[model samples]
Target: MSTDHGDRPVTGVRLQKVLAGAGVASRRVIEQYIVEGRIRVNGAVVTELGTRIDPEHDLVDVDGTAVQLDAGKRYVMLNKPTGVVSSMKDERGRPDLRRFTREWPERLYNVGRLDADTSGLLLLTNDGDLAHVLAHPSFGVTKVYIAKVDGRVSPQTIAALTRGITLEDGPIAADKARLRDSSHGSSLVELTLHSGRNRIVRRMMAAVGHPVTELVRRQFGPLRLGTLPSGHARELGKIELGALLTLARRDSPAEATPGEAREKTRDHGQHDDQENG
Candidate 1:
């Protein structure tokens, strides 16, 4: 299981990370299992957090059950449907994403989560490293959503949302927002933001007096929901994968995209101009 260079384990990744990505358990739970003498990597019990294993070549088992790993990492886009939880298992007995993963014997976990009521564009992967970067708020991977709200969203309300609104948690705003459509007292609005705050979009809309009735994630970073049927999944293409990783490698959230740089600079320049005025 050790792919080494000159007797030093140089390839693969931390054992707990690999196990967690394989959907065996959470990293903390896996660490406890390691100490309890239940996890074996290539027939050797692993207790050290530093232990590395080639997920491609490592044979891992827990409590006599084989922990399967893919020969290569898998990345898939799921157009999650409302009412289905975005997890491998749902304790409440609701439908979960495990149905999609049943085709692949290897384990995979959701990159983040899509609240059961707010569906679309969920990433599922067995690559823990990629998952960590995309999910970490420091990377600021942008997510786009379409919301159907309870009232006609005015330009002033939209401006307030763009300028930022204070919710119960804190002030949060969309990087971009516009009314997509309005009909029968319901308004359709699109929002783009990088903050991963739980239910940020719904809360923001509500704060602006336009409570959202339905929400769907349209894009996650570089990946789009695009015609993918609800409750179905598709493997990410190489080009899409490259773009996603590029976003993940940003030095900081502010540097994620060229357009973002201009926006940040404008925010600073606007303040300076106001002071001079």
Candidate 2:
């Protein structure tokens, strides 16, 4: 059992942490549902964020749906191709990420998401704790994206992106933004940011008058796309997994809030950038 700073025993995982791995919802959204009295354990409605129950012994359900946690936790990386969604299902019969993991029986959820048009690295895992920690805004995990946008993205655009821009939701800033290459008609610019807002990269670029033609996520924290072929996936090796865990452990989420935590936790690929504005 882990002990908190106040010497309280932290037994089992937190309720939100456990439920997020079930792939029914993200941790932030689960917390909202819990506060709304939508989650129950052992027939009792539980709205406690710190409530911990044994996954092996407790009867956990969300809105009457029993939560089944995967026994074997797996960490994987997929080079998602264009036109493939980051979700497990799509109502319009669009291609989803499930096609790449059909061989694996365990239901693996995407750690985050890349929009249908964005092609690049995506993490898939069954470890709910890690997923919650990594996606939490307090950790500020950086994602690197390469965007091919219309026009030679001007110096003004780079400055605006690097400094910050105001979106309909709020003001957001990129950690870094610079021109990787420039041509007569288009430019390839690289953007690094920790924001998880829907269509953030696309919106930022579009706001600067350079609508993105193609976008690809090359890296997320310590994980990178490398030379992986599109639509293929492989288990993360020891080193990469260790690096990710180390980063997650850097902060214990002492100051995470529901509103701030919603930044990237719930928005992954849910909104199309083409329609963001």
Candidate 3:
């Protein structure tokens, strides 16, 4: 199947595939609906497993309701505020990240999570592939946090954090750890880690005898929190998005050289302050 695109043949994708790509549901689940005689192609019931669909031309329906492939998936970063859950729908009926994005057309989900009390950079996206890449530990997407702890942290404590710490979930370590400020028996420390374990930052501080009083994520991978007002969101620009895709592709042996990688990192750092200052 193909669609005419200014004399170019753009291969047409199936309705079920398009729906899955839109983060609606898995192909298997969509197929189940088809088998139940709930799906139609161009107004005709399509129970055949191999039914092909041209999304641009065909009218597809599920359960007698029309289904159109959502155009242009949305990728947004939210500066989640305190007291708001980082969930799509909260069972407790409390405010959630969705409140900040209720007007958006595309459905979005948090890339990872942030505790209700921990406010900072939180990613919301309808792009499932990018979400998977950002959340997956294998990609080593670094998350940086600025934490205010109850007690002073010495060089030894910072060293311990950098070296490694043991927790019930298992051993964990920060890629970088340093004291940012020390005053009035309380200290602010910056921590960078690739692990997405729940409450890992607070737990790590507790393990080091300095329970955290406040926590705020400052950065996520190449994306930074910057001066985005609490509860506001902004779309990821093309350059940043490209950098992330390049980073993901770097896993392959044929990827860019280390020098190129460093240059990209340096460029990202230069703009970090502007984006999140």
What is the lDDT of every predicted structure here? 0.73, 0.75, 0.71
TM-score to true structure, per model: 0.66, 0.66, 0.65
Error of 3 at 206 (Å): 0.4
* Candidate 2 local lDDT, residue 32: 96
lDDT of 1 by residue, 110-132 (tens): 77777778888888876655565
Per-residue lDDT of 1-277 in model 3, one digit per residue for the tens?
A: 3323465545567656876775557999987876788876765787756556676556565655444354665668789888887677767898877687777887777777787888999877765545555554455578899999998899999999999989998999999999999999999999998876768898999999999888899898778988899889988775555455455544423333334433433122122221110
Query: Per-residue lDDT of 1-277 in model 2, one digit per residue for the tens?
Result: 1213456557787778877876658999999998999987877898777777777656566765555555476788999999987777777999997788877876677776677788998888765556666655556678999999999877888998988889888898889998999998999999998877778889888888999999988999999989999889998875676567556644538554333434444343343222111
Candidate that beats the other on TM-score, 1 or 2, i.e. the better one: 2
Backbone clashes counted, model 1: 0
lDDT of 1 at 134: 59
Candidate 2 global TM-score: 0.66
Clash number for each model? 0, 0, 1
Model 1 steric clash pairs: none
Off by over 4 Å in 3: 1-71, 252-277
